[model samples]
Target: MGRPPGAGAEGTWESALAAHLAFRGAVLDVAGSTRRLSGELSRLGESHWGIAGKAAGLFVPHVEYGQSQLRWIDDELAAATRLAHAAAEVEDPDMQLALLRLAGPRLEAAMMGSMLLAVWFDFLNLTDATLSRHLYSVETLYVKMERWQKMLEPSMSALASLEPEQVESAAEDMPALVGHLTREFASLLDTIHKGAKVLETALVLKESMEALTMLSALRFSLPAMRPALPATLGVGLMVGPNGVMMGTRIVVSAEWVEMMRQLVRAGVLSLPAVSAAVRIQAGHVMMAQGHGDLPRGVRDALGDAPEVRAMRVTGKSGAGMAEPPRHHVMPNEFREWFEKRGFTGKMRIDWFCVTLQQPHHQAIHGGGNWKLGRKWRGEWNQMIMKALRDAEVGAGRMLTQNEILKIVAGYMKLYDIPMNFVRCRGK
Candidate 1:
């Protein structure tokens, strides 16, 4: 939160896909430049540069989140484009123009409110990345510091041997060289103390964010955000992997990503956004974004948890509609994968379940056309398979259910899938 919003170039979200990419490039450039500055620091050759650089790397998660949102939003932009083109056939020129703008404007509106999160997620280690969260932790700071000190040990020892054994060089009387070294050491300690304070304050803020998250986007930071559960699951970064993590500077929140999807789909495929756009009076400039004072229910309702999503789909419960199909939270296709893990004995895969509607199941799997389906469904499956396979192979053993779930939570966020499910955990 200490990092302010990014001062990106003057542009619109209409080019959201491109904007997202450009945002990533710009961040990477700055981060690269930041890392390169360590070269100047490296002249000292004591690895202090590494210690300070770790503090600067805290934004890695920000980059990851931004990139995660970018993948999902690419789909959004495609949907928006489809809608913009569709509007030309169904509506007048004025209406079409308004509809076209929705490609960027609707997403802009949805992503707008989430720009400033009321709650801060401190559960993560100095970064926003949920998966592969390998940043320089304070615990590791001390370890690196030792190496840094060792690098200078030989030189310092040499200096110590000549520390005026009795001030025989009194004629020169230039003050002991060790005194300057002591001052330098004090400076280093002060810097470390300040760094520790920053990390400590971050922890306190995490608690504060949790307590006040009543109005936050999704409760996933507290637990996880899931579509079918009483709660939700964590979504991945707005951008990531080789970029400066300017949190909320790029895509805002995953909550915004979902809403943006809904708004875009509504505008392109149907009437929700189209009708709303038509109603805007002439000489108007998207007055409804209302970011300055985002109403209470907006952020609170952004999550797509089972209850929240159900409530949004219909004003009330589905009294007569067919119940959603029940599916194992862990895919059935990967049963062998689970059995090899600790899923045997008390931990049965069937114990964890959720109701995934037929349409959604299809959407996630790219169940439709064979060719285009190859794009999303295949990649999604490959990612899940690769994660599990790689983790086990790397560790050279089966993974626990919780460990497996950690992997699941991350992929779900990247794909923007909800993590609602009923589960029974066991030893």
Candidate 2:
């Protein structure tokens, strides 16, 4: 007589048991890395610099949270390892299948926990390095610090919502439950990865802007010195190698013009710069206390030109004595701009990527074909089928019809999978 519907194939079950053992070994390596990172962070926290000291203190809570999760994962992995070894020695298909089912959730929880912990570990390390290198007094650095902290909120919220207990409770079919947990955990990891990238990009931009602001100030001030200081600051800003001519009209590149417009649209340029530009274009100064009035004055002054058009003409042309644009944003406008981009949204991986690479893409589709290529689609489908087969073998049994469908649905949600492909076939 044929075996029961959920019965395991002997060779496949054995191979599955072996795979679990290998996975347990891999988890052990992750545990070692986590421990080392935790130790390194602890050492860094003992440093003496005030800023580093403050940042280290703030980072403690996140490290503690990660450590706690790591401990839980370690326990789960230890237990799973024990169960896998016992299953490997077993001859009965039913007994081995039962052991595999029991180990599944523990393994899933450990894997998810490890991934979440790694995200925090990486964030802490990056924050520490950034804080150590730059002073917080600089406006760009301060803004970068604030942005990093704000970005952590969503990640922390996601981490807190991770319910490993749910994994155990909901996992009726081991393979399907493992698949579901894998998808959910992967989605969370991707979110955290994108968030980290955003923070990194912010830091880079902050550093660049700080240098630009300093050089621009020096460029304007140095030339006005009594003896006229050497034109060191004019190296990049000046149109000629001889350095800037005091009363000569300055010329700017088309690229510089485009960049100023983008910076204005992003709300990163200072209100004072906008005000000064408006004054220059309109031939009269406006006493504006806030950004609302500044943008209006600018619009009226420039008339149909881009909001930042004055900036292109301000410092670059006409005697090189024009006021250079400041790199600070008005607080209210920055907050509004941030919110409009849905920075607080639950699934912000797409938003985060767009913000880091092309801020303009947030409001509109960044001009790309949405259709998947036929070859790419075929490759994706094959990969999915392979994953499903491996999952079944690792679980030591054929997944139920409902369990298979649920796994498919989880993949669909996780990847926004297209419906045009053939349904996944099961062994």
Candidate 3:
């Protein structure tokens, strides 16, 4: 197609809008992914390994990244629209070019503005959860110490009331009661100290996670796009009377790059600092209120009864004292159906890889793989029971990660065969 005069001045605004829309969609998807990942982490508990570990730490960062991107997109879109409208109103080529140049850095600033918001939102929930867990530990210590105080009050009262002859009997019991009280006090102090330490550790983790979040946001975002004047036929035609061809290179302003770099660095430093503060607050809360919030029965039992005390302290340190095992959610017929359909080997592995990497794409394949994995992991114990009930999968063999992957792949292949597969978007 032959170049139309002043075509660059006319179509630049339309092209900018299209590019911004594409960026907007991608940012929203990233935001959604962050949300989904956060929810998954919250559900999995702090103890669950793999993505859950990363998630516990990344929640704030994820939100921050998303928020930053979203804000940038919104601002960029608004500026682009205004510029387009302004361009529509302008008849002068020089004036239109001036408008484009002014809008360039503004668009870039809009794009980068989202980084702060992204960091703030990404890990907020995960950090909150960590704080909650720390506080819960402190509450436990408070309960222990409160019960000890109550027990000592009664002993102290009885010792004060005893008569001379009864003093002998009282004296004998006195040693035991004093010893019990001393032991209880020491135990309470120990628990308080331990809880404090845990709070400290959690604070550190939160700090580092926050720092990471900031770094990711600042370093990876788009910088401002500078407008460049076309340097070809126009300049040559203008200089024709002087018998000379002229050209100029469009250079993006140095200020724009420097501003972006600074913003990113500032975000990186600030996020960790904010997270550290949150952790410090949480730790203080945990240390001040150890075990105070536990059920009354549990508290009383800790101080008054030797058996209960042993169970609380000793059992806590032992392997048998752990929380009940979680169950999985896989079904009986799922494996059988897959085997019946001859789903195996490379096909299964390839699908598993795809589903793991591109969950959205797998969803289009009726997404049975993701659905099964979600069902299994969502409420683990129920899934285990269901698996146990099935003879083929249940036989003496426990489910492995590979088995789970296979099941997901098979389910995907079985139900999603007819759906057209769309390749994943973005690099």
Candidate 4:
């Protein structure tokens, strides 16, 4: 019943850091662009002119830059808030504006807290993505290191057992091998040490940033303002092969692509339009028109069907309804395809697209419809298993639902898919 070893301290530190980051990111996001947290200062401090000019060689990508910006803003906000308190105490108008100005957006109040929140959450997303990739990369690297260790262990053992002449002969042609292994070992040590340093620096920055987050207490003490979670939806379309487009609905906390993948695995959603878009993108066929309606029509058709009607709709809409059109719920068809290929259920795979019928004029005043471009669905599990193996996660090992979902989400993040689309097997 005593606390687990080191759990209390670790938890407290993490909690503190999370709180600081959350509040800081909120303030910065709310204060868009005006008094912006520029990379200029950090770049200047580090003397990295390249980041300011070409914007290349950034340790993190644009998404990570957004996160770093949030961290900086959090630090800035804490500083400004402290100044604001001081100015208020001394009745210094300039100082007060300086503090409050840091809180405001460039030209619009809309740019304020809400935008910062958006960016902060975006940074969270980007961090999640990087963490996933890093985890996979680290895992792969460990495997490779193990192999290298095995090779080195045996070679060293053999060298120790051999006479001096034998040892010299074995190592004669591979003179560089000794040096290479030594360098590699040193490099690995450096990587571990530097990684720890980066983590420590991040923690220190969190502490500095936390000073600004305390301003929330200042606001909470005031009756006029209160903390609230801002709600806004940003959606993106992910098109897959054929005329299949998945309409991905995303929220700050939602993994849009992964959500779609779940729906696809459950057979509750289809993204033919997005699929068509990807096919056009991949140049599988000449660009064709009139495929946009397929996803929408499929949603409508499937909705009216008894089978679909009986299915539980996990998504919610403005009407407080649990289900809406599949397109609105899941937008990225490629994600759907990806998940389906990786699913492990007993569902038979259909590697065909979900196409819609378009209205066209026929002879004799009869109206007819034509099939549009296709969206391919199939035994996606087999395909995805290979990809997981290639990424060195070990395909032989079975994944639980959550692990599978995580991997699916990671894959989408790796590929920079705007949304994660998934569906379930048909009943």
Best by lDDT: 2
Query: What's the TM-score of each model vs. the native?
Result: 0.25, 0.32, 0.22, 0.17
> lDDT of all the models against the reference?
0.35, 0.37, 0.31, 0.30
Determine which window of 10 residues in candidate 3 has minimal summed lDDT. 229-238
- Which sections of candidate 1 miss by over 4 Å? 1-317, 367-380, 423-427
lDDT of 2 by residue, 199-225 (tens): 555455345323432211112222221
Tell me the lDDT of candidate 3. 0.31
Candidate 3 off by > 4 Å:
1-76, 81-93, 102-105, 122-126, 135-427
RMSD of model 4, in Å? 29.6
Model 2 RMSD in angstroms: 25.7
lDDT of prediction 2: 0.37
lDDT of 4: 0.30
lDDT of 4 by residue, 281-358 (tens): 222121223333233433332232445333322234446644332221112334454355452221112211111111
lDDT of 1 by residue, 1-427 (tens): 0111342422322333332333233223323432332332232123232322345543333333333333333333344344343333421222232333323332332221111111111112212221122223555444433443343333323322221111112101111222232233334323433443456553543443334222222221222323422112233432232221112233333333343334333222122222122111100121133222222232333322344323223211278876565556566678777888765532456544444666666666674543456476454565677888899899898776556765765666565554433222221
Worst window of 10 by summed lDDT in candidate 2:
418-427
Ten consecutive residues with minimal summed lDDT in candidate 4? Answer: 216-225
Ranking by lDDT: 2, 1, 3, 4
Candidate 3 lDDT, 1-427, residue by residue in tens: 1222555555544433332333333234334534544444344344333223443543333333334444444544464445434433443333333333223333332322232223223234323434444432433433443454454334233322221112223323332333343344334323433444455664553353344332112111112112221100111111111111111221112222233222222111111111221111122221123233322332332222344222111112246655221111223235454444333331221121111224443343233365554454423324433443363455555544334333433343443421111112121
TM-score of 2: 0.32
